[model samples]
Target: MAPGIIEMLIVGFAVGLTGALAPGPTLVAAINSTLKSGWKAGPLVTLGHAIAEIFMIVFILTGLYVFLGEYSLFVVIVGGIALIVFGALTTLDAKNASVDLSKSPDNAGNPVVAGIVTSASNPYFWIWWFTVGSALLLTAVSGGVIVFLAFIIGHWAADLGWFTLVSTGVHRGRFLLKQREYRILLTACGFFLIGFGIYFLISGMNL
Candidate 1:
């Protein structure tokens, strides 16, 4: 069952727009990176997010065919533990979330590390794996890899576009600032991260 161009476009548009627009961990990271580190860090962080998504897509595509609907309490428990740890770390960091404006941009590794850690640590990836992600793969069974690839490409492009816009806006607005306000914003972000982590933990436990 080959997918028509219209079907491909629909999936592409739906996935791209929704995924790019959806407010989540990655979006927060992108916004924060732009505000703190400027354009260089923001895009690097976004690339890191893309890497995480690649890993997730690969994991889901390969294993889900066999693991679908098989409840893995162990995985759930592990994820829950991770969430609690992540939440705790975020809460602690909230107190020291200040970014140094004068910090050299030569440290390329920071953005990459930040992006990877931010995306990988997020538990929502697992939920997406089971829901819309799985559906995409299932649809691909009839629609073929072409459709899957198209959707993935579209989704990533949208992510790039969205983050670029955010980065541009932040840079143009000179979102960087003096030390005190920076610290406050960082603390606020940290609080949000902690809150998200706790929510993920609780949701995982309930499931």
Candidate 2:
């Protein structure tokens, strides 16, 4: 059965949150922008990230969908496994995960541009698209365009939500969440990912 809209949203949020928490250039860009541009940097950076994701999907659509359409089950299974692995990692790492809102050097570029450039340049971003992202995206697409859009909306919401909180906290008080709270949040999201991974696994089997 295709996931309901709510389930899709949860899945997207969980998966996207898992990605956003990881240390990466985009995270750096977000932090730096927050330092230079204040709370607006988070949303602005997310807007750029959204653009980059769309651009990547467009690029993947050129010929990738042809193959994906044929081997969607395989893709879903792979995605499920990846999600499980990622979730496990997230859960384990949560114990030590820290959100650093510290100001770096004077290297604050345009928040939007930095989001695009940092994400595009990150190997983790490409690996995600090629592996886990493509799979969940295939599942979303199989459900029809509305579901696909829902997935994207949920994904973007996660990005916007997190960065917004980070920026708000950073701009107002240098750190939005304390280290312990951040770890707890990470652990919760990790478990959410694991659950979604299992859901995807079953969905693939049904297909």
Candidate 3:
């Protein structure tokens, strides 16, 4: 591959890995879907997440990229409120976290839908993609469809790898379900998510 292509791929993978591993609705959805269905559901959920990211990136790159500069204050305020609410909810959920494997025959489709909805509905995602993702794509390549597509593939691959590992581990070690320490860990993750949300909100306001 050309040097530009190689660089874009690396950037794609890095962004993908970091974003995929970040604590958020998509991650929670992955965990829930894995437990609800099975390993097979993991990839489908990941695909949905990737699809949402791709859509967001494209939307921002197009003329639809409405610069929120005029509404920065409003956006910041809204984002802050969302973060606080989301964070509190996440912390509460973690406190009472438990897997309910009860599944219906028609529930197979739920994981995919859940993944899509969670990813699409996340306000954080909209902020990140519009601000960061669009910038990356604009700088991805001066010209080359192959290179752009490769970037997308690399990004998606990272998400797929992460979801696969997370679900596989959770499925294999159901013992985490029985351990109080694990519950604490989940709670910590929740707290951290809230912290992250608050940070984002404040950062938005200052911007």
Winning model by TM-score: 2
Model 2 residue pairs with clashes: none
TM-score, one value per model: 0.57, 0.93, 0.61
Query: Where in model 2 is the C-alpha error above 4 Å?
Result: none
Candidate 3 per-residue lDDT, tens place, 38-68, comes to 6766688887887777677766556433554
All candidates: CA RMSD (Å): 9.4, 1.5, 7.5
Residue 6, model 1: Cα distance from true site in angstroms: 4.7
Task: Write down the lDDT of every candidate, Cα atoms only.
Answer: 0.57, 0.83, 0.63
Off by over 4 Å in 1: 67-109, 174-207
Q: Ranking by TM-score, best first?
A: 2, 3, 1
Highest-scoring model, lDDT: 2
- Residue range 61-149, candidate 2, lDDT tens digits: 66578877788778878888988888898899998888776758277889999889998888879988887888877777767788888
Instruction: Rank all candidate structures by their lDDT, best first, as comma-separated numbers.
Output: 2, 3, 1
What's the CA error at residue 191 for candidate 2, in Å? 1.7
Which of 1 and 3 is ahead in TM-score? 3
Tens digits of lDDT, candidate 1, 25-116? 56666666666677765678778988877788787767875565354344444444543454355446545554323333343346667678
TM-score of structure candidate 1: 0.57
